[model samples]
Target: MRRARRTSGKAQRREVRRLAAASADPALHFLLLLPLALLHLSGRAHADLAAYGLVEALLRRLGPAAGWLLAAGLMAGLLWAIGRIRRRRLAWRGGLLLAAFEGVLWGLLLGPLLQLCLRLVSLPVAPLSVPGSAGALHGILAVAAGAGLYEELLFRAALLSACAALFARLPGLRGRDRLLSLGLAVLVTAALFSAAHALGDPQALEGPVFVYRFLAGGLLGVLYLARGLAVVAYAHATYDAVVMLWSSPA
Candidate 1:
């Protein structure tokens, strides 16, 4: 009985390790973000989110009922794929739980750290734009999730991946030089990440805020590389949620 229990314990540990490792997979990031995307699609009030305009245009072109059918089909396909992953990796759950803890804990820690750094230069920090109305609270969470998921997909997954791939192809950057290449890619993407904010919110482009975002982007770039997209996305979203929902001026 002792040997049997020991064998079972070892197996459980191995399963836990495997599930933890699977959180880094982009597949899980997609799984985490998909429901949020669908939520944005379902409600016209959530219309403030990105790409809803494009999808809405599609609905107009295809007819509203037809557009929904298409959306349903796509959702079904995505869910089926996620189900396969669930069976393979324990529902890709490790990071999902860990993300909440990371989001809340890091969100609390990051603000003071950034403020201390900025205060050295005697510059006042810019507040992240958050709606103050009681009803806008839900909107705050939705926007945070959208921003985190979308920005990570754009800046980290697509842009950073492209930059890293480009560096890998350059001569004399082979072998352990991969780290150097990745470092460069992170810088390239972090710069773009900061700059991209200018396209959305005017406040984001202000001097103090821009610098804040650049620094934050750099940290997120490193975090994304280490923890993968799901962890980083949740961290970003939760940080924003903390700032907005908790009434903290980050």
Candidate 2:
């Protein structure tokens, strides 16, 4: 009996740790996302890069070593924040794994996949643009940091939390109803996320692209639920980084 009780207690503690790491206010998450949104909206500055057609300029300024250092520092900050809340150590291995899966795998590959799917339905592809070598590398690093961390914070943490909170308030929701409400939240937020991207580039998708956004948003939402902000942020950042990197001339 004692052994059984200990196992149960240990399982409960583990669950608690996971939940704590994943929790964040939806609004604050959105606030973290402001810089990227602003960067996107900043016409002159954005146009400067677009006009230069240099993918590597900013990256050159930082240099490879320095750019990596910056990435490491940002990752550390993210882990530190997670630790403070959950009292869990984000091991280097786990960090790397998160970076590999979310940052590299999803960001780059998903875009193309979605594009292919959209083609079937007659949606045109958005031409990939990148900075010069120096700028491209650095831009990717910075974007990975900003977009990955901030967007996840906004959509997954703030948006999800708000929806969940709002849903929870209705007394009639219980069990299955509560689950349905949460699903509704995910759907609504996913639509908003898709809309946000559509605003950035109208011609970026077709029928398949819409499906892609929906799936990606849902994937992020689920990741937010399963792994917390850090994992999703890593994935988001990685995705942008790849897009920036791949878009650049080799």
Best by TM-score: 1
TM for every model, in the order presented, reads 0.72, 0.53
- Runs in model 2 lying further than 4 Å from the true structure: 1-135, 171-177, 204-206
Candidate 2 structure, TM-score to reference: 0.53
Compared with the true structure, all predictions reach lDDT values of 0.68, 0.56
lDDT of 1 by residue, 1-250 (tens): 9999999999999877776766555556666666555543344363353423444576688775876797698788678757867676553566556554564566566677677767876878765553222236566667666666666777887788899998888877765567888899999887887776666577777788877877777777887888777677777777766776667333
Alpha-carbon RMSD of each model? 4.5, 10.2
Q: Write the per-residue lDDT of candidate 2 for residues 41-160, one digit (tens) a residue.
A: 333232323212222365577787766875686577665555543454423333334333453455666566657756776756643322223254554566445556555666777888
Question: For each predicted model, how many residue pairs clash, with residues at least 3 apart or on different chains?
Answer: 0, 25
Model 2 worst lDDT window (10 residues)? 46-55
Question: RMSD to the native, candidate 1?
Answer: 4.5
Alpha-carbon error at 117 in model 2, in Å?
8.4
